[model samples]
Target: MSQQPYAPRPQDPRPRGGTPPSGAPPYPRHRPPRPPATSDLRLLLRLTVASFVLAVLGGAVGLLAAPGQLTGVPVGPAFDTFVLVGSLVLGFGVTAGLYALVYFPLREQRQWAWILGIALASMALLSTLANAALLLVGPAGASPGLVTGALKAVVDVAWLVVAVRPGVRAALR
Candidate 1:
């Protein structure tokens, strides 16, 4: 029928000296996860570059494959060669150069590069959506061009979405 002094019991979850119980992590369990590692940033850079490259490559494929369908003139080997070379230049050459412009500076954590990369990503997303809208309005239904345009739009959106993530943005900063 008597009350004792209130005190932390032996089973108190909060360990002394701010240390966690045995087998627990050094940080609090509720602590937010650390920023992405350098390797992760590198991977993200590669992924974003790859997504754009793939989008360009897919465009090159569509140009070569479907443009001929749009033309009434007979296709020739020379025409095919021209299309291939042009796509290779625009897709592989130009895209590579643009990405290189962003990639190296971004790797070095340049603030301008971060801004430029975001701007470029936004342009790419806009271009994809515009192209998709064009394809949807065009006479072709479910054509390879339309399909590829849709695919590119998906990729571009994904790239921009991931590029804006806290980890990716922090890496750039």
Candidate 2:
């Protein structure tokens, strides 16, 4: 039998001289899911400020505990100098790095912000842990009587608090 006539395709009543069916959404209409407001920013900021402050204070303590570490570059019998120098470098480096990382979200870089934040937070945690270890293992053995030592302890705890903050953890997601 003869095939039935093909039904006319429904006509799009769009205005005549109007734009053609420009392929799906000109460009992909994908909008990344936004992250829920997180408490991490506060935590991160607190940690960063605390870490920086502690680094400065720790540097001061190292200066007092082992002045020679800075004044003179020891060629021998300078274990104190070595420890002081190593600690100062580590403390400053880690703190500065974390501070920078923690600020990424303020820029609202979205996913990148969270990524860098988590990475930096982890590093900060490790750095503080290492500092605590040194304080306990070295001669001081967490018995630092100086105000700077107390400051260092306070800031280290602050860092831990930030790392565990809900906002920061959410940012990681």
Whole-model lDDT, candidate 2? 0.59
lDDT of 2 at 31: 71
Which stretches of model 1 miss by more than 4 angstroms? Answer: 1-40, 69-91
Candidate achieving the largest TM-score:
1
Across 1-173, the per-residue lDDT of candidate 2 in tens digits comes to: 43645533358434344554656354356777656556666555666666677667666666666543344445654775677669878967866776675565633535566556556555645665666666667665335424555565566566656655667656553
* Residue-by-residue lDDT tens digits, candidate 1, 94-141: 777788888887777665876777688778778877776776787665
Let me know the TM-score candidate 2 reaches against the reference structure.
0.46
Q: Compute each candidate's TM-score over C-alphas.
A: 0.59, 0.46
The C-alpha stretches of model 2 lying farther than 4 A from their native spots are 1-40, 70-98, 106-109, 135-173
Q: What C-alpha lDDT do the candidate models reach, one value each? A: 0.68, 0.59
